[model samples]
Target chain A: MHDERMISFMFDTNLTKHLAELSKINFTDDEIAVISNEMSEIISLMDTVTEYNIDETFASADPVQFSDLRKDEIKDSFPREEILKNAKGKSDTCFKVPKVV
Target chain B: MNDLLKCTVKELSNKLNKKQISAVELTDAYLKRINEVDGKVNSYITVCNEQARISAEKAQKIIDAGSANALTGIPMSIKDNICTKDIRTTCASKMLEDFNPIYNATVINRLNDNNIVMLGKTNMDEFAMGGSSQTSFFGGVKNPYNTECVTGGSSGGSAASVAANLCAASLGSDTGGSVRQPAAFCGVTGLKPTYGAVSRYGLIAFASSLDQIGPVARSAEDCGIILSAIAGRDENDGTIKNIDKADYCSKIGMSMKGIRIGIPKEFFGDGIDSEVRQAVMNAAKEYEKMGCILEEVTMPSLKYAVASYYLISSAEAASNLSRFDGIKYGYRSENGNTYEEIIKNTRHEGFGAEVKRRIMLGNYALSSGYYDAYYNKAVKIRGKIKAEYDEIFKTCDCILTPTAPSVAYKIGALENDPVKMYSADICTVTVNIAGLPAISTPCGYSSNNMPIGMSIVGNSLREATIIAVADAFEKQFETKEASI
Candidate 1:
């Protein structure tokens, strides 16, 4: 149902820029073309969701509810050294981050 | 005996209990097998030869003390995504190539408690993203049955290792059929328990709502043995249900009489290969001959399952994967000066094409203007689909369908075509969306001698029923084991 012109239009619109900014990843022009074509195809397939009219009260699937939560109690946590083992920039006892203005 | 590698978990346990074969011997046999065929199969990312030997020694002591558990001496592989303390848990991505978790996943803790010997970490689709193992930065996992074909993924390596006798059983995380489809392609039995059935505390998140850690083994009984050890309420994972421990192994030989099996009409429609359809239909017939009832059920929302699954899973993935920046625990980029630029460059260089495409799609759907149109609508439709399944379950105990639309395609058959790759998950994704338990067991073989799998889906937490039906059906077929 989607045409090439519309696909290009969707790509040219803020869609590409917004996605790049949102995901914090840049793409080449050719990459954009390929991604745009794929996105357009996926969007057309996803259009089927719009065909069904869901009730306003319809709730998403929640197999386990929070009411099943165990009583909150003080418990042991992972050791501090172990927790910081994967930190890229870390001091002896704290994680180091970039300076903010 | 070198043939000990081909025995089931039960057989291995019995042999260990009788002192016929020591755990060290079994571990050595599997290690030898890995050294032999892993060059062509490439099922393992890391072979824990030394660790397995140590565990096997400990297990031999346990057996000597007369305290051997069902899987005490069993040598198995863990999917690379599962964190094992001091061992690298690369999700087959360059991002975490050097990263090692300080703690083991909760399932790993249980396996250790049972004295199960771990052979190694199996390869997988990078961050469990792709349908075929081709997306792994390590390399594609080949099908044991046909070396030219792919082992369906992202749990392809786990299934392949089990099929090729690289290990007795293995654990894999299923998010959108990662466990089931690959098990089918490799002719192994794989179960994806209910979303909260197994604790997900230490699993590297891939669509957390749908992710579950389950077992892949030679038979449903082995899956049950592994599941019993792993399934229970964990205080660390609040999503775990507080139910009594299920005796999954006891349900294997149970009668299938008077059980109702629903065959979804939509699952057999267009896009399914005629061979797969025939095989699944033949499985249903076998169930009927075992005195089970087969009813054709209609779930119209299934037509939208692939779309809904992609949207919802990608949205969750976008949020879940946001933590993997250059700041913590993964690949860092030296090309950028600023923090933001460094993060962006790191992600761009580290992620595979499929991962990047999914992140882009997810961000696009969750972007400001499109959230309501794409993500929200997809969630609503997901609710409708779940509701339809709920209604169907009232009339039937479980549902049956082909695990995948076709047998394993060639290694590069769908490399360039991403949408077609997503379509291959059509028959298996609905169970994940519904948060139900399902098992993929080899039902028959295709004309090419590749294995065909059928999925037996049950309602939430109904793993016992699903496994029982799968065991019954699998026993009816004389499926050819893959000879590597």
Candidate 2:
């Protein structure tokens, strides 16, 4: 099942660093080195999926049918205090965070 | 009363109903066992001693009123990820270390309606990200069989709690064999209901498409009892389909005659340990002895299972876990001057290494340039896997395979090697991908006495059939107790 064409994706420390940035995570140089090596190995292992030449016609992702879902009934929400209880910075009804600007 | 710890859920229910033991006494017995040995096992992140005793008192009242059911007054641990109304549902991560849900998960509500006593929140891999429980911030859960080894995770604590008699049974979440693998490692029974069988209204999602809440217990019947109580149509979760079988134990003790057990040759390949392979094969022979037919089947897509599973799961996880920003009801960092900085810093500080790695993988897979090569291809492979399982089930009643490639390894052995750790999930991930019901029960033990588990994978919503098959094997299986 191993195919030469499956080995096209390139993974390296640079890619790992970029992905971490996209993921909103900050890793140290040492951590990046370790994670890069691990990610390269994992991605290589995952490359097996590329071997299958599945017809895309059969794979138009099955959308969850609306009929399968239950009727969305209006219900009382959790109390404001309860909702805000676990937030680190919270006012009476809202979670407080740093200024976006 | 201490001997009562050895009883199954049904046996204990009988004792409680017969007035041989009060709910309080049974709860206390399990609580005492937990208090004594949990230091060594580290199975629990939080033990609800005071609340458990209080709930046990309430259960006694229900029993006195003659309104008790099978799980009434039964003490069981809940996985830390499942939301409980007032209990700290930590998810074994610093992110939600003290976050308490103001509402009970649908399953918790169902169990509560049955008057089941909650023991506490059991530990797990941080955000259920890793295969081994060592990634937990609260410290890893040690195997009850051998404390030096890992209890296969991310339901490791739940399985260990059941194996060590910390509780009569426990609830766990399975995403890529989390519940079954840990149960196998700890010598217990675990069931991963079809994706939509159990409601996921309040299960903290790891991979939304693959995640399922299940039971870990002493026997298949015990898991059945728990599943029956917890599973049903829930208006809160849109994914739950109306299942016909309300009682999973309804077909227990049925004859295995004429049952076609499928043995997929791909599952027992060079990757599987010889001992685990032999043990599962021995289990097939046991089924054959019970007059069941054994047929060698094929799942050609099995080789790509692990890869497909990781890609899809991580993609969903990236989306599901993005909600845990600093503004939310979880851990926050004080080091940031701006909103983005706060969110990024909080995540870096809160999540463990494995969780971060998965998030990175997920981001990489879903990123614009790689979406077609990774996530989309994974979804197609998933469809192919489900189709293959459908064809196999057309010819077989159930597919049997080793729950994991091998028995539990020593702690820290596979944690550093991401590929090795992910490869171990090859045998079990397809069931989740197909949304099938499967049970992992202790079949045989390794030469060094570690437990080996064999899984019976049934078609979608065939939970009762698989449970019955597991119960049949469990009745004759001489399972060893963990020497906690």
Q: What is the TM-score of each candidate against the true structure?
A: 0.96, 0.97
How would you encode candidate 1's per-residue C-alpha lDDT over A15-60 as one tens digit per residue? 7656867887766668777777777776766666666667755465
Q: How would the docking of model 2 be graded?
A: medium
Worst 10-residue lDDT window for candidate 2 chain B reads B236-245
For model 1, residues B170-189, the per-residue Cα lDDT tens digits are: 99999899999999999999
Ten consecutive residues with minimal summed lDDT in candidate 1 chain B?
B364-373
Best by DockQ: 2
Q: What tens digits encode model 2's per-residue C-alpha lDDT throughout B1-484? A: 3788988999999999999999999988998888889999999999999999999999999999999999999999999999998889989999998898889999999999999999999999999987789999999999989999999999999999999988999999999999999999999999999888888999999998888999999999999999998887887877787765488988998889999999999999999999999999998999999999999999998998899999999998988889988686888988878888888888889899888888988998898877887889989888888888888999999999999999999998998888889989988899998888999999999988899999999998889999999999998999998877
Clashing pairs in 1: none
DockQ for all models: 0.50, 0.57
| Segments of candidate 1 deviating more than 4 angstroms | A1-9, A55-57
DockQ for candidate 1, C-alpha atoms: 0.50
